[model samples]
Target: MSTTADQIAPAHDEHHAPRGLLRWLTTTNHKEIGTLYLVFSLTMFFVGGTMALIIRAELFQPGLQIVEPYFFNQMTTMHALVMIFGAVMPAFVGLANWLIPMMIGAPDMALPRMNNWSFWIMPFAFTLLLSTLFMDGGGPAGGWTLYPPLSLQTGAAFPFVILAIHMMGVSSVMGAINVIATILNLRAPGMTLMRMPLFVWTWLITAYLLIAVMPVLAGAVTMLLTDKYFGTSFFNAAGGGDPVMFQHIFWFFGHPEVYIMILPAFGIVSQIIPTFARKPLFGYASMVYATASIAFLSFIVWGHHMFTVGMPLAGELFFMYATMLIAVPTGVKVFNWMATMWRGSMTFETPMLFAVAFVVLFTIGGFSGLMLAIAPADFQYQDTYFVVAHFHYVLVPGAVFSIMAATYYWLPKWTGHMYDEKLGRLHFWCSAIGVNVLFFPQHFLGLAGMPRRIPDYALQFAGFNMISSIGAFLFGLSQLIFLWVVIKCIRGGEPAPAKPWEGAHGLEWTLPSPAPLHTFQTPPQIDPSEAHG
Candidate 1:
């Protein structure tokens, strides 16, 4: 039963990848590592999603029903940590591992061993973080921000959380470094930086963001550890330290961290929109500048997140204006996507459906973010479900939708089989409807005065909470269909052609379907006209 892929191999597969358990443990193949990262991220997605379901179940009714209050808090805390660290970040890294070398016309990553180590470090780190739940006092319940005083109250679990975070940071930094080096050094003869795909460009910038902010996060957490155990009082009020200082520092890294999660997503949507729209991306050079502009603005806008803290009027105005300025570049992106689709031969495949939804829905999220940017308005929105709704809108639909789009766009190439399109659309509808139903209610609930991260709420807020919970359940179940689609495609279907999507253009697509274990061993020559600018 050896398949067709076995009958045809790319130039670099002169030596076959080893098979079985030892292969995964000992190998340095980028594709294998990418598969590992993707699989692991999906597992973590379910794990994190289950935690979210538990929280929603508890909030389904007015009072506590499913879990104890302490455990509920732990669920909320662990859910965010898992989704951000375990799920989202790893998924992007996985995409990078799979596509970067191929797109850049390189045999493999420049620092292959470091890439392997970076991914391997994740399991141990998350294991340590998750194991904290079994400790005497439960997991870190101070929210993912790990703010002081409340953060210091996590009993035996605090130190472990800090260590886990530090380890994850190390893994991120390593992955970022590998990406930077590989892209800088490994392009083919004519594949200049400006001509590289948007996905690669976005990742190049994202790696720098990671390298810059991960260490700041490590330092922030380490300082928190010292404040808790070593009595350093970096954030201790009694020791003449301002807790607000931690807010300043945390958001400094935190704002860029938000971009870190979404920038690759921007890259993804940029790639998909054009392919489905049957056009070269509009305003290619402006798109690059816009992405770079957004990254640079990310550093200055950290203060927007903390406008509710008692800052001076000048500081408030500066942060508010700076935050709003991000809309300019972001608007450039949204407009370019629209322009790309304006007059083109458009097809609404599953990936396009999601990308289209991302543009509209993610724009809603961005709008809400702008509203939150106003220092005066933030007073009303801060700490409310509005803030929760704002971010989930961005991350879930914004980042998660792009990931779905990428999965569908590339799955055929990855597996050499076409996924069920009918089922794919079904999954998209369920997700699109479910996501709106889930978060859209929260905006109303927040404006009506429901605070976030609460275990229980008053009867006044009960209806929307119930609606949100039902939506959460539906949305959660929809992902099972995605899992089925992925597995079914991987097992086999109609064999895919080398370039399954007719309009698709990239170095990777030039290779065989289910791209060979080794690709671009002898860097391909790129024609200046054929490549992107």
Candidate 2:
């Protein structure tokens, strides 16, 4: 087995890759496809972020200042859709595509053609969804959840949104399949299941979750399509269908989908904490078990999201306890991260800053989640700004922060140049402060009896809304600094060694900075002592 850095392909294979735009279109290379995924995700991030700024801008003042209420609804609906499916999910998948093969010491993803197809589907799917905004009835104003009846009321946008969702689902399922296949079959000699990096481990579990639930969402949306156009009544109360049943099916997919987004973040933090702490991860096997436990609990706790929908007392109690039970494993993970850092020679690079912030802030999100888990408490919090605050805390600082951490941690390796550290820290601070200010006041607004998804609020909610809007602008603007950091690093910077971070571990670190287009054509031998559990 070879332990060498990725090497350029032999001269005979050089011409096989097409030049320029054709290279991107026809390439089956994992690294190139991964770059494509990252670039697309960045584009969508701004697209969705623009929608969010519009929402914040409208709510910056008291009443109907910027856009009409219907347009506001479209912004809310499309913002959630674009962020969840287009921005966050694709970012994780992009990371998977770039790092998974390298981590496992495989040359490329298993089923390369499927990988290419999976990525190409996204731009078209999103285009179809976004095109609806220009149509007669405007884009989906029914919210990202696409709850029935209201969703059924959507005009020309109905079929387009549904079809776009189906296409996104199909793309995700295929990407998940490719991930599972690559991880399961393409590991190098001695890279056993447990020996694989935590990033790889979390993605493996996430892929399984995707396989299980994406189809459920696909089915639910298909039912919606049928109910709307074909006179079926899967969720139409007029035809004897139960709208509550739609909530059940949707949440069944929705709760696990939440974990699907965050679980990869968990893997990333698990990797970074140990690296910066200059220690092998603490309780490595326990972390793996804890991740699996959280995944298992995710399926059972979907009912909590629907506690206010008039579930029977017994059902409500069942969901409440099940939801609370997740805190146990999550607590384990948090404890392990702290323990990993306990008394170690810890450093606070940009990546470490984000990872540490993920722990504290995401814990805040989790505690609020616990608050929501209590069935009786949920009755107050549901459909309120508190719920908005809770999830944004989880997502923006939790998952999105982890993605940023990963970019900083690996950018040196990816670009073979060290980024400007000072700028990176500035981006992190602005993001951290801005996110809290943006979200913390929303918690107060929810407690003050403010509802979510409304464009305008009563005069009483004005001050906190103003503060939240300011934070939104600050947070949104901070990302430009991040964009600048990435671009600058790509063009020119201090040249990096193969292993830029002294504490970093894994097969990826073993490869050179700016790893070659093709890597590990001969499998690398794994050293048990160096395995990142």
Candidate 3:
């Protein structure tokens, strides 16, 4: 009689999967593409981090000792572009690729060929973007927002930057389409929408958000391209176009873009907390609804970013209240996370430590966000280090930390080897301390009337800037430990079991550790009792 493994194994042999460098270049396998995206993301993370350190080095003292003012601006601009587009977003996409099909018991993404194409496009897009830094104008320095006139001043780099952005947008949109198609069409039998994991649900919502907003950014940049070269004047003051209109259009896409980066983070944290707490996620339905609510609120609150632009009092009030309204759904998610951990057999593993930090630190960011949402208060904080601090808290601890947690949570399954927990904890503590020391003082700097995006600062801002720079170095250096841990695990470690975490519940854990090149070739049966809820 045939064994159970023989009965359930993929119809084809594993050797049928492509091999060698050509496999990575041309293969349609979700797992390989996911690895490519992840490795690319990690590479870019260091690239972006280097730019950040350059910035800190310059600001280490009140004077501009290290780099020229324009180069400083370039560092700030390029750093945001690299981190947002190159690092964090792709890292999340990589996670989705690796886990979504496994979670829902699909054999592969619905559009595997398109998935391959999506990953391939990113390298070229970023290459074109980074190439601009060497051009005469020294990259687009008007900020990643690329506000026009100032952005219009960008020289030979202009068209290249726009093209690079378009390429990134195309890649993102195609990836989003793949995600939606996969989730909607490829779920295993009995895997109902409500039964899917939060990570899948969040990506579904995020995919829609991507489809909706990526084009707006594409359009805005296209207009910028036209105004610069084709003379269309969409944001030109002399041509009777309003520069502020660019801000309006940008923020309309920009704010939802923020949620696009974050909703999945909420999803990641949602998955981790319950696993470590040894509890079914508290208020699962509420968490789903809250994520949806946050996405909805994101579109209406774009005006808050433009409050200092002198809108009418009514407009300001409306944006302020709408922005504040987001807190309701956000609060629900936070409360549910805490409740899930309440009185449970909690394990403080690396993933849980990061998850817990995400809750606390992200809440701090949220509170600071509320302060910025106050129309009058934003006037004080707008474009200062306070704004910088607020967002870093959100993106770093909030989004980046969640990504790190997911890595630790799933690395065992991916590598079939457990990461060194001792070293993992060390990375966590160093990162946690370093990130705070880097960002926290900036809030005080902004409150004390220090402006942002400048090479030099007033004498009063010196002490905090120095402290912040030290923190930046600390945080940047700590990432080496993270890199070491990942490499070490991949090379050799104690073998991991299929279910490394006792409390973990998902279809992913049903597969053998270091999940096969092909999985769910025959759809795995879903059990309602084993659902993540």
Candidate 4:
């Protein structure tokens, strides 16, 4: 067998030992903690997805058939918060936990004890959050952005929500620190930064972004809390603070928050495209630079989401152009994917299906985002169903789709069993078509003038809304098929070979299926001669 890191490295201090439950509970084993994080994020994904289903149901016919306006608002706000924080964000961290060591030839994440702490905080934090649903006034109705004044009017749960956000922030900060330490300190002697996988590179950048801006969110929300109880309003004009200032602070954190969700997707797609296509990723150096530029750009464009809240024309124009400028590098990434796929042997396994769909559908979202970048158009598009349509396209098909692709691609390696290919394809098509049906018409409705976040709409919006509702139901149900596929694959299936795909290339692929707990007890012996074979 062609040897990789796990086989070549010598066993280190106790990292390879499989001990008691305390080892799992307190151990720094990257693989164990990574598994825990991924499972937790998936659990939250379903929880948040359920909340989304409720929203889709309420919007089904536009007659306010479900919960009251107050309850509906809580659902929307918490759903976004849950999906972003509990689902998408942590999933990426989970990926980092699982892949970073394998990719970089590290025995385990640096600061393994802290890694355990990071993973453990999330459930308790979200428990604090989910508990708010049963409170006197319902969860935070001010939306996930949690703009103040309206936020101040909400129930006692607001305090709980604030504290949850704080706990989550702390978890994120610790996770980021662990990731940074591992990447900088733990790489094998021969694995230079440039030699690292794109996924690792992208995640390295993302963890830094988290460390930078997450605290701003903490501080802003803390101020909101202080104003509500302490009567010192940072956002209340009556208390001598400006409300718009809240928008400034929130979005300052908000804009980068969006890219934090997407940059890893860029890295994941970069890795998958080249591996499936049997080529080196086109412009790897450029892709790294592009990810950085996008992160840098994120800080300046927070106002794009807040244009309707009233900024001067100069403020609006500065933001509009800055926001639009994101397309250049993003376009570079899309082109790289196409170029990788342009003239190569490719197969449509479950992972490839999801990856390919991610390419097409996520671009559609990007185009909608481009349209939204127009200052004149945004005045109309802000806070409408079109915005909803745009992000879902990017996120569901973008980040979430990429995550699914990563799962299917690597499940064989993780579980040592090949997933059902036919079932996988079926899952892809059902989800692809269902997502479009669910959200595509939303673009039309928003263009035809339908506001988002309202319980009801006028009669003219009825037909399309009904169609979207049906689509939402199907989309929701199709995911169960996905759940079934994952469960079946993990429990039993045909065994998978090391380097399962002929076209696959990477350090991780060199390891056996069902990778051992301490396989990379020491770094692999690398030689340029052996790589070509």
Q: RMSD for each model, in Å, please?
A: 4.0, 2.9, 3.5, 3.7
lDDT of 2: 0.92
State in Å the error of residue 85, model 4. 0.6
TM-score for predicted model 4 compared with the true structure: 0.95
Error of 2 at 224 (Å): 0.6
- Model 4: residues >4 Å from true position, as ranges? 1-24, 527-533
Write model 4 residue lDDT over 413-482, tens digit each, in one string. 8889999888888989999999989999999999988998887899899988988988888888898888
Q: Estimate each model's TM-score.
A: 0.97, 0.97, 0.97, 0.95
Model 3 C-alpha lDDT per residue in residues 203-245, reported as the tens digit of each score: 9999999999999999999999999888787898899999999
Superposition error at 22 for model 4 (Å): 5.3
Per-residue error at 47 for model 2, in Å? 0.7
Q: Which residue segments of model 2 deviate by more than 4 Å?
A: 1-12
Estimate, for each residue in 1-533, the C-alpha lDDT of model 2 and write its tens digit.
12112332223154787899988987677888888888899889999999999999999999898999999999999999999999999999999999999999998888777788899999999999999999998999988988887888999999999999999999999999989988988899899998989999999999999999999999999999999889998998889999888999999999999999999999999999999999999988898999999999999988998888888899999999999999999999999999999998999999999999999999999999999999998989999999999999999999999999998998898889999999999999999999999999999999888999999999999999999999999999999999999999999999999988889889998888898888888899899998973
Cα-based lDDT for every prediction: 0.90, 0.92, 0.92, 0.85
lDDT of 1: 0.90
